[model samples]
Target: MAHPLIDELTDSSFDELISTAEVPVLVDFWAEWCGPCKAIAPILEEIADEHNGQLKIAKVDVDSNQKLALRHQVMSIPTLILFQGGEATKRLVGAKSKRDLLADLAEVISN
Candidate 1:
């Protein structure tokens, strides 16, 4: 089962979503033309479903949302930023495996 993912975000909604989320958030900075971004989409969906109540998976398109992408210093596509308490705690650039993502996410959530 795959959980629903927040596939787009704006500056207006970013604060409310990240700052006010009850659990940790994984924000994926992606673009329509990025192969790696497309590759990781399903994996992200799966993780979201698996950690339904514990975390959130959000996707931001760099091409459409340039401001938001710049704010996060996203120089690369498919960058995953882990947010806790409205602050970015971990940043993973490029595509990563599910096992690595799980381990990294677990480390943050546990702290």
Candidate 2:
């Protein structure tokens, strides 16, 4: 199951959420059939819990929101994009360890 804090983003809600967020928004671009995406979900949930106020977590299902996936140039599953100041600051593709995920966010969240 998805964490309560993680927002399920669609085409309409995607731009609004990312644009208006006060903190860095980490968006997970995934598809239902993607194994790597599923593998990284728990790590994302933990990050969401650990960094609740410092960062915002959102997920976009590539299948449901094809336009968003295309717009973001998500060529692979489990694509994680960190959006700061309404622009994509970091992009991580494929599954990542919790340590790596946290390390990637540390700089962004601290700023």
Task: Score each candidate by Cα lDDT.
Answer: 0.83, 0.90
- For all predicted structures, in order, the TM-scores are 0.89, 0.94
RMSD of each: 2.6, 1.6
Runs with alpha carbons beyond 4 Å of true place in candidate 1: 1-7, 108-111
Clashes of 1: 0
Give the candidate number with the greatest lDDT: 2
Error of 1 at 65 (Å): 0.7
Q: Model 2: clashing residue pairs?
A: none
Q: In candidate 1, what are the lDDT values of residues 75-96, reduced to their tens digit?
A: 9989999998999999999898
> Candidate 2 at 83: error in angstroms?
0.4
Report clashes for each candidate as comma-separated counts: 0, 0
Cα lDDT tens digits for candidate 2, 18-51: 9999999999999889998989988888888888
